[model samples]
Target: MTAKLADKYGPWGVVAGGSDGVGAAFAHRIAAAGINVVLVARRVPVLEACADEIRAEHGVDVRTVALDLSASDAVARLVDATADVEVGLFVYNAGADDISVPFLDKDVDTHLSLVRRNCGAVLEAAYRFGGPMVERERGGVVLVTSGAAWAGGASLAAYGATKAFDLVLAESLWAEWRGHNVDVLSLVLGMTDTPSLRRTLAAKGDAAPDGIATPDDVAETALRHLGDGPTWIHGAGDPTGPSPLGALPRRDAVLAMSRSWAEE
Candidate 1:
Protein backbone atom coordinates (compact mmCIF):
# COMPACT_ATOMS: atom_id res chain seq x y z
CA MET A 1 0.00 0.00 0.00
CA THR A 2 1.08 3.58 -0.62
CA ALA A 3 2.55 5.45 2.34
CA LYS A 4 0.41 8.44 1.46
CA LEU A 5 -2.67 6.26 1.49
CA ALA A 6 -1.81 4.79 4.86
CA ASP A 7 -1.32 8.26 6.24
CA LYS A 8 -4.59 9.27 4.70
CA TYR A 9 -6.44 6.53 6.59
CA GLY A 10 -4.56 6.48 9.83
CA PRO A 11 -3.36 8.76 12.57
CA TRP A 12 -4.27 6.70 15.62
CA GLY A 13 -4.73 2.91 15.47
CA VAL A 14 -5.65 0.37 18.11
CA VAL A 15 -4.85 -3.32 17.71
CA ALA A 16 -6.58 -5.69 20.09
CA GLY A 17 -4.08 -8.54 19.58
CA GLY A 18 -1.10 -6.32 18.95
CA SER A 19 1.50 -8.18 20.99
CA ASP A 20 2.80 -10.44 18.22
CA GLY A 21 2.69 -11.81 14.69
CA VAL A 22 0.14 -10.35 12.26
CA GLY A 23 -1.21 -7.97 14.87
CA ALA A 24 2.27 -6.66 15.64
CA ALA A 25 2.90 -6.02 11.95
CA PHE A 26 -0.30 -3.99 11.74
CA ALA A 27 0.98 -1.93 14.64
CA HIS A 28 4.30 -1.42 12.87
CA ARG A 29 2.79 -0.31 9.60
CA ILE A 30 0.46 2.13 11.32
CA ALA A 31 3.31 3.45 13.42
CA ALA A 32 5.42 3.89 10.27
CA ALA A 33 2.64 6.17 9.09
CA GLY A 34 3.36 8.25 12.20
CA ILE A 35 0.24 7.03 13.92
CA ASN A 36 0.14 6.67 17.67
CA VAL A 37 -0.80 3.11 18.57
CA VAL A 38 -2.54 1.51 21.49
CA LEU A 39 -1.53 -2.15 21.95
CA VAL A 40 -3.84 -4.51 23.78
CA ALA A 41 -2.93 -8.06 24.78
CA ARG A 42 -2.80 -10.47 27.67
CA ARG A 43 0.93 -10.31 28.33
CA VAL A 44 2.52 -7.09 29.51
CA PRO A 45 6.03 -8.13 28.54
CA VAL A 46 4.97 -8.98 25.02
CA LEU A 47 3.11 -5.72 24.64
CA GLU A 48 6.13 -3.83 26.03
CA ALA A 49 8.44 -5.44 23.50
CA CYS A 50 6.15 -4.58 20.59
CA ALA A 51 5.62 -1.08 21.91
CA ASP A 52 9.36 -0.55 22.33
CA GLU A 53 10.06 -1.42 18.71
CA ILE A 54 7.37 0.92 17.37
CA ARG A 55 8.53 3.70 19.64
CA ALA A 56 12.13 3.29 18.62
CA GLU A 57 11.53 2.99 14.91
CA HIS A 58 8.50 5.15 14.24
CA GLY A 59 8.65 7.63 17.13
CA VAL A 60 4.98 7.06 17.77
CA ASP A 61 3.42 7.08 21.21
CA VAL A 62 2.72 3.49 22.25
CA ARG A 63 0.36 2.57 25.05
CA THR A 64 0.20 -1.03 26.21
CA VAL A 65 -2.75 -2.59 27.95
CA ALA A 66 -2.56 -6.05 29.54
CA LEU A 67 -5.91 -7.72 29.59
CA ASP A 68 -7.20 -11.21 28.83
CA LEU A 69 -9.99 -10.54 26.37
CA SER A 70 -11.38 -13.99 26.89
CA ALA A 71 -12.76 -12.77 30.15
CA SER A 72 -16.42 -11.78 30.00
CA ASP A 73 -15.66 -8.32 31.35
CA ALA A 74 -12.90 -7.58 28.87
CA VAL A 75 -14.81 -5.35 26.46
CA ALA A 76 -15.94 -2.98 29.21
CA ARG A 77 -12.41 -2.82 30.52
CA LEU A 78 -11.03 -2.07 27.07
CA VAL A 79 -13.50 0.76 26.50
CA ASP A 80 -12.78 2.22 29.92
CA ALA A 81 -9.07 1.79 29.47
CA THR A 82 -8.82 3.56 26.13
CA ALA A 83 -11.67 5.99 26.69
CA ASP A 84 -9.38 8.95 26.82
CA VAL A 85 -7.66 8.36 23.49
CA GLU A 86 -9.05 9.27 20.08
CA VAL A 87 -8.38 6.35 17.81
CA GLY A 88 -9.11 6.62 14.09
CA LEU A 89 -8.60 2.93 13.37
CA PHE A 90 -9.76 -0.13 15.29
CA VAL A 91 -8.67 -3.73 14.48
CA TYR A 92 -10.55 -6.53 16.13
CA ASN A 93 -8.05 -9.37 15.76
CA ALA A 94 -8.02 -11.38 18.96
CA GLY A 95 -9.34 -14.94 18.64
CA ALA A 96 -9.48 -18.39 20.25
CA ASP A 97 -9.18 -21.65 18.35
CA ASP A 98 -11.83 -24.32 18.41
CA ILE A 99 -11.11 -27.49 20.35
CA SER A 100 -8.98 -29.63 18.04
CA VAL A 101 -10.85 -32.84 18.59
CA PRO A 102 -13.74 -34.77 17.21
CA PHE A 103 -17.06 -33.05 17.61
CA LEU A 104 -18.25 -35.50 20.24
CA ASP A 105 -14.91 -35.38 21.99
CA LYS A 106 -14.87 -31.62 22.53
CA ASP A 107 -15.88 -30.16 25.85
CA VAL A 108 -18.87 -27.86 26.08
CA ASP A 109 -17.00 -25.38 28.25
CA THR A 110 -14.22 -25.01 25.71
CA HIS A 111 -16.73 -24.41 22.95
CA LEU A 112 -18.55 -21.74 24.90
CA SER A 113 -15.29 -20.11 25.91
CA LEU A 114 -14.14 -19.91 22.31
CA VAL A 115 -17.46 -18.34 21.33
CA ARG A 116 -17.21 -15.76 24.08
CA ARG A 117 -13.68 -14.85 23.11
CA ASN A 118 -14.03 -14.89 19.33
CA CYS A 119 -17.55 -13.61 18.70
CA GLY A 120 -18.72 -11.87 21.84
CA ALA A 121 -15.53 -9.91 22.50
CA VAL A 122 -15.28 -8.76 18.87
CA LEU A 123 -18.90 -7.57 18.86
CA GLU A 124 -18.46 -5.70 22.12
CA ALA A 125 -15.31 -3.94 20.96
CA ALA A 126 -16.76 -2.98 17.58
CA TYR A 127 -19.97 -1.59 19.01
CA ARG A 128 -18.61 0.12 22.13
CA PHE A 129 -15.62 1.86 20.59
CA GLY A 130 -17.07 1.88 17.09
CA GLY A 131 -20.08 3.90 18.19
CA PRO A 132 -17.80 6.72 19.22
CA MET A 133 -15.91 6.54 15.93
CA VAL A 134 -19.18 6.97 14.08
CA GLU A 135 -20.08 9.92 16.21
CA ARG A 136 -16.73 11.43 15.42
CA GLU A 137 -17.75 11.00 11.76
CA ARG A 138 -14.42 9.47 10.75
CA GLY A 139 -12.64 6.21 11.52
CA GLY A 140 -12.19 2.62 10.31
CA VAL A 141 -12.97 -0.79 11.75
CA VAL A 142 -11.22 -3.94 10.52
CA LEU A 143 -12.33 -7.35 11.69
CA VAL A 144 -9.97 -10.32 11.33
CA THR A 145 -12.13 -13.25 10.46
CA SER A 146 -11.02 -16.61 9.06
CA GLY A 147 -11.52 -18.12 5.62
CA ALA A 148 -13.35 -20.87 7.43
CA ALA A 149 -15.96 -18.29 8.39
CA TRP A 150 -17.45 -18.46 4.94
CA ALA A 151 -18.39 -22.09 5.50
CA GLY A 152 -18.93 -24.68 8.17
CA GLY A 153 -15.86 -26.71 9.04
CA ALA A 154 -16.90 -29.48 11.33
CA SER A 155 -13.43 -29.86 12.78
CA LEU A 156 -13.49 -26.21 13.70
CA ALA A 157 -17.22 -26.03 14.14
CA ALA A 158 -17.21 -23.55 16.97
CA TYR A 159 -14.42 -21.41 15.58
CA GLY A 160 -15.98 -21.31 12.13
CA ALA A 161 -19.33 -20.28 13.53
CA THR A 162 -17.84 -17.48 15.55
CA LYS A 163 -15.84 -16.20 12.60
CA ALA A 164 -18.97 -16.29 10.45
CA PHE A 165 -20.65 -14.22 13.09
CA ASP A 166 -17.76 -11.75 13.03
CA LEU A 167 -17.87 -11.41 9.23
CA VAL A 168 -21.62 -10.90 8.98
CA LEU A 169 -21.64 -8.53 11.92
CA ALA A 170 -18.97 -6.33 10.35
CA GLU A 171 -20.82 -6.30 7.03
CA SER A 172 -24.00 -5.21 8.77
CA LEU A 173 -22.11 -2.54 10.66
CA TRP A 174 -20.70 -1.31 7.35
CA ALA A 175 -24.20 -0.76 5.98
CA GLU A 176 -25.28 0.94 9.18
CA TRP A 177 -22.23 3.22 9.30
CA ARG A 178 -21.95 3.83 5.53
CA GLY A 179 -23.01 7.44 5.49
CA HIS A 180 -21.15 8.20 8.73
CA ASN A 181 -17.63 7.71 7.20
CA VAL A 182 -16.72 4.86 9.53
CA ASP A 183 -15.26 2.34 7.09
CA VAL A 184 -15.89 -1.21 8.24
CA LEU A 185 -13.79 -4.07 6.86
CA SER A 186 -13.82 -7.80 7.34
CA LEU A 187 -10.60 -9.69 6.50
CA VAL A 188 -10.86 -13.38 5.69
CA LEU A 189 -7.49 -14.88 6.47
CA GLY A 190 -6.10 -18.23 5.40
CA MET A 191 -3.45 -20.21 7.33
CA THR A 192 -0.83 -17.71 8.43
CA ASP A 193 2.59 -18.35 9.93
CA THR A 194 2.20 -17.44 13.61
CA PRO A 195 3.33 -18.94 16.88
CA SER A 196 -0.19 -20.25 17.35
CA LEU A 197 -0.04 -22.04 14.00
CA ARG A 198 3.34 -23.51 14.85
CA ARG A 199 2.07 -24.63 18.22
CA THR A 200 -0.96 -26.21 16.67
CA LEU A 201 1.18 -28.13 14.21
CA ALA A 202 3.46 -29.33 16.98
CA ALA A 203 0.58 -30.36 19.18
CA LYS A 204 -0.81 -32.41 16.31
CA GLY A 205 2.68 -33.84 15.68
CA ASP A 206 2.60 -32.77 12.07
CA ALA A 207 5.49 -31.73 9.88
CA ALA A 208 5.61 -28.27 8.30
CA PRO A 209 4.52 -28.37 4.71
CA ASP A 210 4.44 -25.55 2.24
CA GLY A 211 2.25 -22.52 1.30
CA ILE A 212 1.70 -21.25 4.82
CA ALA A 213 1.62 -17.43 4.87
CA THR A 214 3.90 -15.35 7.06
CA PRO A 215 2.74 -12.71 9.47
CA ASP A 216 4.43 -10.02 7.41
CA ASP A 217 2.69 -11.22 4.26
CA VAL A 218 -0.66 -11.28 5.99
CA ALA A 219 -0.13 -7.79 7.42
CA GLU A 220 0.96 -6.35 4.09
CA THR A 221 -1.97 -7.84 2.21
CA ALA A 222 -4.46 -6.69 4.84
CA LEU A 223 -3.06 -3.15 4.86
CA ARG A 224 -3.16 -3.04 1.10
CA HIS A 225 -6.81 -4.00 1.14
CA LEU A 226 -7.58 -1.57 3.92
CA GLY A 227 -5.86 1.17 1.96
CA ASP A 228 -7.79 0.11 -1.11
CA GLY A 229 -10.92 0.43 1.05
CA PRO A 230 -12.44 -2.86 -0.08
CA THR A 231 -15.31 -4.05 2.07
CA TRP A 232 -13.91 -7.62 2.24
CA ILE A 233 -10.43 -9.05 1.57
CA HIS A 234 -9.50 -12.68 1.04
CA GLY A 235 -6.07 -13.93 2.09
CA ALA A 236 -5.34 -17.00 0.03
CA GLY A 237 -5.27 -17.28 -3.78
CA ASP A 238 -4.57 -14.22 -5.90
CA PRO A 239 -6.35 -11.10 -4.66
CA THR A 240 -7.90 -10.71 -8.09
CA GLY A 241 -8.06 -14.37 -8.94
CA PRO A 242 -11.11 -16.66 -8.80
CA SER A 243 -13.28 -14.03 -7.16
CA PRO A 244 -12.98 -15.63 -3.70
CA LEU A 245 -14.61 -19.00 -3.11
CA GLY A 246 -16.00 -17.61 0.12
CA ALA A 247 -18.12 -15.21 -1.90
CA LEU A 248 -20.16 -18.29 -2.83
CA PRO A 249 -22.14 -20.49 -0.47
CA ARG A 250 -20.03 -23.54 0.33
CA ARG A 251 -21.01 -24.85 3.70
CA ASP A 252 -20.84 -28.50 2.66
CA ALA A 253 -17.66 -27.95 0.68
CA VAL A 254 -15.93 -26.46 3.71
CA LEU A 255 -17.05 -29.24 6.01
CA ALA A 256 -15.69 -31.82 3.58
CA MET A 257 -12.33 -30.07 3.32
CA SER A 258 -12.17 -29.60 7.08
CA ARG A 259 -12.32 -33.33 7.62
CA SER A 260 -8.97 -33.68 5.91
CA TRP A 261 -7.39 -31.22 8.37
CA ALA A 262 -9.05 -32.87 11.34
CA GLU A 263 -7.03 -36.05 11.06
CA GLU A 264 -3.86 -34.07 10.66
Candidate 2:
Protein backbone atom coordinates (compact mmCIF):
# COMPACT_ATOMS: atom_id res chain seq x y z
CA MET A 1 0.00 0.00 0.00
CA THR A 2 2.81 2.36 0.93
CA ALA A 3 4.75 1.65 -2.23
CA LYS A 4 1.63 2.07 -4.30
CA LEU A 5 0.93 5.44 -2.71
CA ALA A 6 4.46 6.51 -3.47
CA ASP A 7 4.25 5.51 -7.10
CA LYS A 8 0.78 6.98 -7.63
CA TYR A 9 1.36 10.17 -5.70
CA GLY A 10 5.08 9.91 -5.41
CA PRO A 11 8.11 12.22 -5.55
CA TRP A 12 7.05 14.57 -2.73
CA GLY A 13 4.43 15.32 -0.09
CA VAL A 14 3.97 18.67 1.68
CA VAL A 15 2.60 18.74 5.23
CA ALA A 16 1.53 22.10 6.59
CA GLY A 17 2.15 22.18 10.36
CA GLY A 18 4.40 19.20 9.86
CA SER A 19 6.57 19.79 12.93
CA ASP A 20 4.74 17.78 15.57
CA GLY A 21 1.82 15.56 16.56
CA VAL A 22 -0.38 14.19 13.76
CA GLY A 23 1.36 16.36 11.18
CA ALA A 24 4.78 15.05 12.17
CA ALA A 25 3.49 11.50 12.16
CA PHE A 26 2.09 11.99 8.65
CA ALA A 27 5.47 13.28 7.48
CA HIS A 28 7.29 10.24 8.81
CA ARG A 29 4.76 7.81 7.43
CA ILE A 30 4.73 9.47 4.03
CA ALA A 31 8.51 9.41 3.90
CA ALA A 32 8.53 5.73 4.83
CA ALA A 33 6.33 5.08 1.83
CA GLY A 34 9.17 6.29 -0.45
CA ILE A 35 7.97 9.86 -0.88
CA ASN A 36 10.30 12.76 -0.25
CA VAL A 37 8.62 15.13 2.22
CA VAL A 38 8.47 18.89 2.56
CA LEU A 39 7.50 19.87 6.11
CA VAL A 40 6.12 23.35 6.89
CA ALA A 41 5.65 24.82 10.37
CA ARG A 42 6.09 28.01 12.40
CA ARG A 43 8.69 26.48 14.74
CA VAL A 44 11.96 26.35 12.83
CA PRO A 45 13.85 24.12 15.24
CA VAL A 46 11.07 21.56 15.47
CA LEU A 47 10.46 21.61 11.72
CA GLU A 48 14.13 21.08 10.93
CA ALA A 49 14.40 18.39 13.58
CA CYS A 50 11.43 16.50 12.11
CA ALA A 51 12.90 16.80 8.62
CA ASP A 52 16.24 15.49 9.78
CA GLU A 53 14.63 12.59 11.61
CA ILE A 54 12.51 11.58 8.61
CA ARG A 55 15.50 11.77 6.28
CA ALA A 56 17.55 9.55 8.56
CA GLU A 57 14.81 7.03 9.35
CA HIS A 58 13.22 6.63 5.94
CA GLY A 59 16.28 7.26 3.79
CA VAL A 60 14.16 9.70 1.80
CA ASP A 61 14.77 13.34 0.98
CA VAL A 62 13.23 15.88 3.37
CA ARG A 63 12.94 19.65 3.37
CA THR A 64 11.70 22.09 5.99
CA VAL A 65 9.90 25.36 5.29
CA ALA A 66 9.42 27.52 8.36
CA LEU A 67 6.29 29.62 8.06
CA ASP A 68 3.18 30.30 10.12
CA LEU A 69 0.13 29.13 8.17
CA SER A 70 -1.91 31.87 9.80
CA ALA A 71 0.27 34.55 8.19
CA SER A 72 -1.33 36.47 5.33
CA ASP A 73 1.36 35.46 2.84
CA ALA A 74 1.87 31.89 4.07
CA VAL A 75 0.38 30.07 1.07
CA ALA A 76 2.43 32.13 -1.35
CA ARG A 77 5.54 31.47 0.69
CA LEU A 78 4.75 27.75 0.75
CA VAL A 79 4.24 27.73 -3.04
CA ASP A 80 7.56 29.56 -3.46
CA ALA A 81 9.37 27.25 -1.04
CA THR A 82 8.26 24.13 -2.94
CA ALA A 83 8.30 25.60 -6.44
CA ASP A 84 11.28 23.48 -7.42
CA VAL A 85 9.86 20.21 -6.10
CA GLU A 86 7.28 18.04 -7.79
CA VAL A 87 5.00 17.80 -4.76
CA GLY A 88 2.22 15.27 -5.38
CA LEU A 89 0.60 15.09 -1.96
CA PHE A 90 -0.39 17.73 0.58
CA VAL A 91 -1.68 17.40 4.17
CA TYR A 92 -3.16 20.51 5.74
CA ASN A 93 -2.83 19.34 9.34
CA ALA A 94 -2.24 22.38 11.53
CA GLY A 95 -5.65 23.48 12.77
CA ALA A 96 -5.42 22.73 16.46
CA ASP A 97 -7.41 24.84 18.92
CA ASP A 98 -5.00 25.38 21.81
CA ILE A 99 -7.70 27.10 23.82
CA SER A 100 -11.20 25.66 24.02
CA VAL A 101 -12.94 28.42 25.95
CA PRO A 102 -16.40 29.85 25.45
CA PHE A 103 -16.86 31.86 22.23
CA LEU A 104 -16.90 35.22 23.99
CA ASP A 105 -14.10 34.31 26.37
CA LYS A 106 -11.55 34.41 23.58
CA ASP A 107 -10.48 37.51 21.73
CA VAL A 108 -12.00 38.19 18.33
CA ASP A 109 -8.57 38.23 16.68
CA THR A 110 -7.93 34.66 17.74
CA HIS A 111 -11.18 33.57 16.13
CA LEU A 112 -10.28 35.38 12.93
CA SER A 113 -6.88 33.73 12.94
CA LEU A 114 -8.50 30.32 13.18
CA VAL A 115 -10.80 31.14 10.26
CA ARG A 116 -7.93 32.36 8.14
CA ARG A 117 -5.75 29.36 8.74
CA ASN A 118 -8.39 26.66 8.79
CA CYS A 119 -10.60 27.81 5.94
CA GLY A 120 -8.89 30.52 3.93
CA ALA A 121 -5.43 29.01 3.90
CA VAL A 122 -6.69 25.52 3.30
CA LEU A 123 -8.79 26.65 0.33
CA GLU A 124 -5.81 28.48 -1.13
CA ALA A 125 -3.58 25.46 -0.66
CA ALA A 126 -6.00 23.32 -2.60
CA TYR A 127 -6.11 25.86 -5.38
CA ARG A 128 -2.33 26.11 -5.61
CA PHE A 129 -1.26 22.53 -4.94
CA GLY A 130 -4.24 20.78 -6.47
CA GLY A 131 -3.77 22.84 -9.62
CA PRO A 132 -0.49 21.13 -10.34
CA MET A 133 -1.93 17.72 -9.50
CA VAL A 134 -4.81 18.23 -11.88
CA GLU A 135 -2.45 19.22 -14.66
CA ARG A 136 -0.13 16.34 -13.85
CA GLU A 137 -3.14 13.96 -13.53
CA ARG A 138 -2.45 12.48 -10.07
CA GLY A 139 -2.19 13.65 -6.44
CA GLY A 140 -3.57 13.35 -2.92
CA VAL A 141 -4.66 15.80 -0.22
CA VAL A 142 -5.65 15.18 3.40
CA LEU A 143 -7.39 17.80 5.44
CA VAL A 144 -7.34 16.76 9.09
CA THR A 145 -10.51 17.86 10.87
CA SER A 146 -12.38 16.96 14.05
CA GLY A 147 -15.68 15.55 15.31
CA ALA A 148 -16.41 19.02 16.72
CA ALA A 149 -17.55 19.85 13.20
CA TRP A 150 -20.61 17.65 13.48
CA ALA A 151 -22.56 20.08 15.65
CA GLY A 152 -22.49 23.43 17.39
CA GLY A 153 -21.43 23.28 21.02
CA ALA A 154 -20.64 25.63 23.89
CA SER A 155 -16.98 26.69 23.93
CA LEU A 156 -16.60 25.43 20.37
CA ALA A 157 -18.14 28.15 18.30
CA ALA A 158 -15.25 29.37 16.16
CA TYR A 159 -13.17 26.22 16.30
CA GLY A 160 -15.99 23.90 15.31
CA ALA A 161 -17.14 26.25 12.58
CA THR A 162 -13.74 26.25 10.87
CA LYS A 163 -13.50 22.48 11.10
CA ALA A 164 -16.90 22.27 9.47
CA PHE A 165 -15.54 24.41 6.67
CA ASP A 166 -12.64 22.02 6.14
CA LEU A 167 -14.98 19.06 6.19
CA VAL A 168 -17.20 20.57 3.51
CA LEU A 169 -14.24 21.73 1.44
CA ALA A 170 -12.50 18.36 1.40
CA GLU A 171 -15.64 16.52 0.41
CA SER A 172 -16.43 19.02 -2.31
CA LEU A 173 -12.92 18.79 -3.72
CA TRP A 174 -13.10 15.01 -3.73
CA ALA A 175 -16.28 15.22 -5.76
CA GLU A 176 -14.73 17.55 -8.29
CA TRP A 177 -11.33 15.86 -8.53
CA ARG A 178 -12.18 12.18 -8.35
CA GLY A 179 -12.39 11.66 -12.12
CA HIS A 180 -9.23 13.69 -12.55
CA ASN A 181 -7.38 11.19 -10.32
CA VAL A 182 -6.71 13.60 -7.49
CA ASP A 183 -7.77 12.08 -4.19
CA VAL A 184 -8.96 14.45 -1.47
CA LEU A 185 -9.74 13.27 2.04
CA SER A 186 -11.45 14.96 4.93
CA LEU A 187 -9.75 13.04 7.73
CA VAL A 188 -12.05 13.37 10.75
CA LEU A 189 -10.59 12.66 14.14
CA GLY A 190 -11.67 12.24 17.75
CA MET A 191 -9.52 13.17 20.78
CA THR A 192 -6.06 12.01 19.86
CA ASP A 193 -2.98 11.56 22.08
CA THR A 194 -0.61 14.12 20.63
CA PRO A 195 1.70 16.85 21.92
CA SER A 196 -0.75 19.54 20.87
CA LEU A 197 -3.69 17.73 22.47
CA ARG A 198 -1.72 17.11 25.67
CA ARG A 199 -0.84 20.78 25.91
CA THR A 200 -4.47 21.80 25.50
CA LEU A 201 -5.59 19.23 28.06
CA ALA A 202 -3.04 20.44 30.59
CA ALA A 203 -3.99 24.03 29.90
CA LYS A 204 -7.61 23.11 30.60
CA GLY A 205 -6.47 21.59 33.96
CA ASP A 206 -6.69 17.94 32.99
CA ALA A 207 -3.40 16.14 33.54
CA ALA A 208 -4.35 13.00 31.68
CA PRO A 209 -7.35 12.31 29.51
CA ASP A 210 -8.53 8.79 29.07
CA GLY A 211 -9.34 7.18 25.69
CA ILE A 212 -6.99 9.31 23.62
CA ALA A 213 -5.99 7.93 20.21
CA THR A 214 -2.31 7.46 19.40
CA PRO A 215 -0.77 9.57 16.65
CA ASP A 216 1.12 6.72 15.04
CA ASP A 217 -1.99 4.59 14.71
CA VAL A 218 -3.96 7.56 13.47
CA ALA A 219 -1.43 8.44 10.75
CA GLU A 220 -0.96 4.85 9.67
CA THR A 221 -4.68 4.36 9.37
CA ALA A 222 -5.13 7.52 7.31
CA LEU A 223 -2.21 6.70 5.05
CA ARG A 224 -3.42 3.17 4.50
CA HIS A 225 -6.92 4.36 3.64
CA LEU A 226 -6.14 7.47 1.61
CA GLY A 227 -8.01 6.15 -1.38
CA ASP A 228 -11.23 5.55 0.53
CA GLY A 229 -12.24 9.10 1.13
CA PRO A 230 -14.31 12.07 0.79
CA THR A 231 -14.61 11.60 4.53
CA TRP A 232 -12.72 9.05 6.62
CA ILE A 233 -13.51 9.20 10.30
CA HIS A 234 -10.63 7.71 12.24
CA GLY A 235 -11.60 4.95 14.73
CA ALA A 236 -15.17 5.13 13.51
CA GLY A 237 -17.39 2.06 13.47
CA ASP A 238 -18.38 3.13 9.98
CA PRO A 239 -15.81 5.47 8.54
CA THR A 240 -18.04 6.41 5.61
CA GLY A 241 -21.30 6.33 7.55
CA PRO A 242 -23.28 9.44 8.48
CA SER A 243 -22.16 11.47 11.47
CA PRO A 244 -22.91 9.84 14.84
CA LEU A 245 -25.27 12.65 15.68
CA GLY A 246 -26.81 12.88 12.25
CA ALA A 247 -30.02 11.24 13.41
CA LEU A 248 -30.52 13.54 16.39
CA PRO A 249 -32.49 16.76 16.28
CA ARG A 250 -30.30 19.82 15.91
CA ARG A 251 -31.14 21.08 19.41
CA ASP A 252 -30.45 17.68 20.94
CA ALA A 253 -27.20 17.38 19.04
CA VAL A 254 -26.09 20.80 20.14
CA LEU A 255 -26.92 20.10 23.76
CA ALA A 256 -25.19 16.73 23.68
CA MET A 257 -22.09 18.32 22.15
CA SER A 258 -22.19 21.02 24.81
CA ARG A 259 -22.20 18.42 27.56
CA SER A 260 -19.27 16.63 25.90
CA TRP A 261 -17.27 19.85 26.00
CA ALA A 262 -18.02 20.23 29.71
CA GLU A 263 -16.68 16.73 30.30
CA GLU A 264 -13.57 17.62 28.37
Maximum-lDDT candidate:
2
Error of 2 at 197 (Å): 0.7
Where in model 2 is the C-alpha error above 4 Å?
A: none
lDDT of all the models against the reference? 0.77, 0.92
Which tens-of-lDDT digit does each residue in 38-135 have in candidate 2?
99988788888888899889999898888888888999999998999999999999999998988899899999999999999999999999999999
lDDT of 1 by residue, 102-190 (tens): 56688888888888888889989998878888898888788988776756766777887888898888878888887887878877777
> Can you tell me which runs of candidate 1 are displaced by over 4 Å?
1-10, 96-99, 227-231, 236-251
Instruction: Look at candidate 1 and tell me the lDDT of residue 210.
Output: 82
Each candidate structure's TM-score, on Cα atoms with residue i matched to residue i, is: 0.89, 0.98
Q: What is the Cα-based TM-score of model 1?
A: 0.89
